[model samples]
Target: MPTEYVKRVLAACVITVLSISNTANGLAGDTKEYRIGLTSVIFADGTAFVNDWRTYLTHHLQAPVKFVQRQTYREVTDLLLAGDLDAAWLCGYLYLQHRDELELLNVPLFKGKPLYHSYLIVPSSDTKTRKLTDLKKKVFAYSDPDSHSGYRYPQLSLISAGIEPKHFFAKTFFTWSHRDVVNAVADGVAQGGAVDSYVWETLAEKDPQLSRRTRVVSKSPEYGFPPLVTQRGLAQRRADNLREALMHMSSDDMGSKVLQILNLDGFTVGNDDLYNNIADSIRIVEQGG
Candidate 1:
């Protein structure tokens, strides 16, 4: 049984869902409406990009939809588990953490595959770096405590190399977004940092100023990619409709425009097995790795 708090959250969620269903279903005559929700691990700008993506989904599904910006992955998962979020864009590790509560609508595609890596980075001019051990006692920035590549994967990488972030660095901070982590190192606010290598690579390849300021110190082994997910209890037909909308987003469509803004190629269908490695890593971290 869910706890009292979970029950309360679930109750609120049911109310919201019922209200939306009544309003949208009333107009549909016989068709169903899916109040799809979108959540991302990025900051406000990333949230806006997702909102644009949702706009395309709404048009494609011919139903009402909404997107919400989550400041942290943990918060988004909480909303998802409580049934407040109909669907979300989640990191592999985050999804693994709440595997029972949410299901993947599909995997998001970047340049290609449904996989990416983490990067340990320092300013290009910082001659004193080569490996994770080199940055011992240095100032470091992470995106968030719950972030996959940005925090968890990088933390695990350090542990694998025989260092725990809480004890290894002189001091560490979370910049809360991959872009800011890069900026922090570039500005010398941090001597080094960890970020999603994909975000870093995309920014460097596309944004000259950012590329000029930072350099990759190391990269983690590849892991499952981030994905667009929906709550587990969502109606199957509704989920399928949402998936179809995402999977078909082409360069000639609204998804294309949103993808252009988001620097993504598009989305693909996925399942829970994609994040097994993330679950393994979580166990490693929890066991004091």
Candidate 2:
């Protein structure tokens, strides 16, 4: 074969391999099923939520939505970034870390507000300790290293007070969920932990069971709220359709029920401005100070 022809053939082969890899990895369109994978925080359990949201979305889109459940924030983020998942309900910090690879589709309007905050939780007995600095050298429980309210804000609070998480705590552990972190502290698994203040409030207000065990220690400064995100390069029309479904669906009684379960009043259009601080926090963690 001629050298020029050989070069052209090699480039074509490389492109073919990449296309096949992406398809095999769940990137390519297959059978036109409009599947939506939700990250953690959208569900308290597995089955009921997928059924509820799918009913809402598929009714509007006029297609069946296979609700795929992802176990953690990281897993959802990876799937969304890789184009394996069509959409995700994601926290601000996760979106911040991967915003370049994703687009904000919609944000949930929780309790008639679009923003939420974090809480520092110590035992109810530790009333005198009021600030981040006061808890140094204490055992701490974080839900996950990648969690926004559960890890990022608490870590950033410590760094702002001139303490690094690895150096500040006597020990650290992951409980994998906001409720678990709250339970760990109340159960004395650790001296304290951080959790979503919204979860704390919602559980306290709605679940008398969880409220009996825990109380808030302090509240972190508010940052951008969590959002619904779609993979970058998702078709613009599809993104618009999904956003319209969310924003306009809250007109009837059934729509209200879905919003109630999510602790949301409705859905709203949002942009990237709300998450800039989260990106700053990520940079702090990466720089180790």
Off by over 4 Å in 2: 1-31
> Can you write out model 1's per-residue Cα lDDT over 190-217, one digit (the tens) per residue?
8998888767877876786975688888
lDDT of 2 by residue, 21-57 (tens): 7566444433244657665565355477558877877
Worst 10 residues of 2 by lDDT: 24-33
- How many residue pairs clash in each candidate at the backbone level? 0, 0
| lDDT for 92 (candidate 2) | 88
Candidate 1 C-alpha error for residue 161, in Å:
2.4
Q: List candidate 1 segments past 4 Å from native.
A: 1-51
Root-mean-square deviation (CA) per prediction: 6.1, 7.7
Q: Candidate 1 at 154: error in angstroms?
A: 2.0
TM-scores for candidates 1 onward, in order: 0.85, 0.84
Alpha carbon lDDT at 48, candidate 2: 75
- Give candidate 1's TM-score: 0.85
